[model samples]
Target: MTTTVRVLESSEEDVRRGPEIIIHENKYEFCRYNLKISRFINANLGFSAHVWDAGVALCRYFEKEKINFTGKKVIELGSGTGIVGILAALLGGYVTMTDKPKVLKQIETNVSINIPSVCRHRVNIRPLMWGENHTNFNPAYDFILGSDIVYSSVVYPALIETLRYLADQGATIYLSSELRKSNGSPDFHNNLLPHYFNCQVVDRIEGKDVVVYKMTKIATTSEEDPLPSKE
Candidate 1:
């Protein structure tokens, strides 16, 4: 006999940081597991501490597509709230959830709470600053994921460099972003990423104003060649 799981209503769990900051949990049910994602409510804990629409959309996209994450090596960049990476782990992928050093605690907490002890070893949290020294992380990952990380043009170069270093010809990259015309996300997806990777739209979530792109490294891409400026 099999059991069916439905999307559950969200409940809150609050954690206090010092005298002022309050972190609250946003609950989600996916893959027959309940994910409790914590976020700072009144405190400005940077964007990495909060859950974004792109991340949610990507999680849904994975479930809808029935991605076979079993036994795969996965790494998620800008893993705010650790939602997407947690889902990957639940789906049987060895997942590394990464973000800025300062924001790692919340993600760690989320991972610890949601991932069962049996699946706990499959998930790891690490600090990854885009375009920085990423040598500590393995270059070969079966799948690389990012959500709402392409918001600004200023970070494009470093982000691209990091992507190039972490992804090889055999790896697949999935990036989801809310395509806001005012920001450079639209241009980055349309004009910039295509220059380096073979990119395709895997999902267009119109309701959330989000688009998920599937990208793979171009075989001829050279590390020394500069990416075209996004001016």
Candidate 2:
């Protein structure tokens, strides 16, 4: 039998330097699972820990098909709460987990606690701000990940630009979002025509909403055979 610790409803688990935690006891053991995470990677998903759990569930949608993420260059943008992206790292993606400069350390802390095994060597930390022109973008990510990043109409232009810039020639962009009443999807679709990003609704699960997108460097009208990056 293993020991278990009851999680405090609210604790002074600092959110800045170390991973803020909510220890929960299960049948066998107690674990200091981190919570209250906000921002990992670059895209801005307005975050609430409870709400972000929905996004984490969505990230695992691809696993149902048994597609291995091992040894893939993956980036989780707008990693608000960092849970999804950290999970990706644990699964074996050479994950570059970035976010805003202010919250980069926080993102680092969360990953370290949940997946200390891979954070330093595999999961890299960096700063990626949306709407800003970034020349130091990685061109080798097999998949770009985001969770619930669609927030407001004001941020649509920046978000779209950021997504386009980081995406490689043939990269799969997996996003998890709930179609909320006041989400930014409307504004995003409005600008997608003039720009080019082959977006598609691949999966929509009950508890989690999954949208798979394909992006390319050049513009093409050929919609039938958009070169898929990976499954």
Candidate 3:
């Protein structure tokens, strides 16, 4: 689906001090989140940024699918406002939310305010630069989450490298993106085919112009062939 990229205007109230509450409703429950959004001007230009339409769509998709996150080890890359990771934690996943160092504070704040005290220990906020040496990050994560992270073409290689390095054997990956043509073609999705055995659009919210994909890593194959070689 082709979509025009339009930046939603943030009100003055949304730009003021503390975080703002955005409500995401699902068939089962409503998720109320507090996010510390960047200033309107800064956000429009993609500096740090705010909770976006695609992010909201991602949350709704999680609710609709009723994914079982209990005790799952999950990692979220480029967690702008920590919405997706926080939701995963709320659903019983042990989530690690990562972004650049500059955005870590906002992610921490969002997690602290939205996650219940009992579940707070399940969520970890950290800084991670895509493609950089991830010695500190474990490669055995059961699932990886990313929302609206395909908007930049320059980051494609880095993003793919990060995914390959972090994905465990048979790990699951969930990614959401706004279907905007201006952000470049769906090259990011195409790039994953070789690294991941199965990749497909699992859900799309047309009204919100968002698409979510479910991907799984390719299983290792034995180098030795079973067939006898012709002598």
Candidate 4:
């Protein structure tokens, strides 16, 4: 099968035209913990400005599992609109949301709008590029998260390296990705990731074709061969 592209709009707008805003109000369990997320979409911002199914699925999985994030040190990678990190903050985690330098503003806007004043201190937004020096971020995070980040084969090596660098001995990693071949290949989860980390499927959103995986670094021996190139 082949992928198809549709022109959903009449014509692409100029990058300088600014973003088109869309508000998403998400609530869980008896109207508690309402999160008003603002998604900025336009030609300039690319897919980083929009919410993907993987993000939504991860948010739902968090709610369903009722994971204890209270007082936990957490960081989210590729936090497009900061949805997962915001939700983590709402659940009492000290969360850092990160993405490319360009999209930090959008994540910051969403973080400010959703996180309550008293809890705002728990959330921090930062710029991160995979495979780059991340010395600014501590390696003691209790949890590392990503949604739809495994969207390209080109990023696998860097992504894995970053994960290995950030994760401490006991840190847990959660990643969610859509199963669509057009969006990304499954080989990252099925083949490459397992070599670096012990991976297991923790949640599957029915009908969404999205799966959430839990991972921890595999213990390495000095005699073990180096990881194969993901290029």
Candidate 5:
């Protein structure tokens, strides 16, 4: 017996549009946001942004889990198009959406238009280069979000270091990635073992080759001894 696989063709509407509105819904409400897409063929990758499947999976996972962001401090790494961070802010988180400096403007525009005036103050757009010194960023974030950031092996060390630097001891981390091999190995997931504990796959998209990971920082030992000798 032989098996056949079907591949669906993309429509012209899907190919031609520059910016499009993406609608995501949960049990309670719906989130409607516009995404700015890059039109120039020679434009930088950051400039030509579009929603990724992993990003959509993340949004759905958050909705299903009903993760409470109310009054919590959150940061998103490699926040292209800023969709995940925007969703967190909508759920009442004080969110910082960060990416390369070149992409900040696009994130800013999305935040300005999609985030309501009341929740506007809770959202900030900034530039973040992984593995670099980020002394200006607060070290106590309650939650960190990332989507499709693990596709490149070159960024693994820097990304892991940045995560360790930003996350508080009890901080929750949510990362989504498409299940695809990169540079011949899955270094992005494999490299995270040392710095994080209780790492688990919290969610998976049924038909999409995407998974979301929920992890917490490993407990660090104190540099100084607890017991002190009397003089």
Candidate 6:
């Protein structure tokens, strides 16, 4: 599929046009944890992506010094706007930032925008399409990060399969998503988790707007490797 393109900056007759601005009365902050917004984190450059608010919130959850994140290998799937993966790099872990190859250029742009030069090396951006095989996949990671990815029923299985492929022996997966009705069917969490994964609710508190799930993979009886066997 051909991906849509949005220029970072546009100018006409020396007049500057910026990315469309989206304002939320209940706007949540993820660009920075403190009162100040760092230019590196929030480009103020533009808001072309989806609810980056969720990404900001997820990044805040990691940035707050509340969790012990050290020496872990992390990967963020469907990394739109690449916010969560960037935060993982900032938090002192090796993080792989993934999306389709076509979208990686801007994701790389976003990472370089926020993180220091030394830290930028720690972030690896790779191409990954759901359910399809990629040549350069590393078999293990300590965590899988995803947000708002469980919308389509067809893609849900593929997304879960992709995560299952990268999950390490004991690595945990974290996902944040809002409940939405779909085609007269149950939501992703309600309909999918029970069959493929052993899921536990990490947070479902009132007014938080999204549910965070601590997902652990369920082993299959098929005993088959999804990827080609190691040489």
Top lDDT hit: 1
RMSD after CA superposition, every candidate: 4.1, 8.7, 7.8, 6.3, 8.6, 9.1
**Overall local distance difference test of candidate 2:** 0.56
Assess each prediction's global lDDT (C-alpha) against the native: 0.80, 0.56, 0.68, 0.76, 0.68, 0.60
Worst 10 residues of 4 by lDDT: 1-10
TM-score, candidate 5, is 0.76
Per-residue lDDT of 1-231 in model 5, one digit per residue for the tens?
111112122122233334543222121122333333322222364422655667767877776767779999999998877778888888889998998887776677667767778779898888888877555798788999998877666666677667777875578999988777744224456554433555777887776667788988776643421211111
Candidate 4 — which pairs collide?
A: none
Which candidate gets the maximum TM-score versus the true structure? 1
| Of 2 and 6, the candidate ranking higher by lDDT | 6
> TM-scores, in order shown?
0.88, 0.67, 0.76, 0.84, 0.76, 0.72
lDDT of 3 by residue, 95-197 (tens): 9999888777667766666777988989988889887756579888999998988877677667765776687545699988876667663654665344444
Q: Among all windows of ten consecutive residues in candidate 3, which has the lowest summed lDDT?
A: 21-30
lDDT value, candidate 4, whole model: 0.76
Clash total of candidate 1 = 0
Error of 2 at 69 (Å): 1.7
- Candidate 6 regions off by >4 Å? 1-48, 63-65, 183-186, 223-231
Q: What is the lDDT of residue 220 in candidate 5?
A: 64
Q: Stretches of candidate 4 above 4 Å error?
A: 1-31, 182-184, 221-225, 228-231
lDDT of 4 by residue, 41-135 (tens): 54256778766777777777776777879999999999988878888888889998999988888888877878879999999888999888666
Off by over 4 Å in 2: 1-54, 187-195, 207-231
After best superposition, candidate 1 residue 107: deviation in angstroms?
A: 0.7
Ranking by lDDT: 1, 4, 3, 5, 6, 2
lDDT of 6 by residue, 105-187 (tens): 65776676666897777889888887787335876788888876665666765776677777646678888665567631245
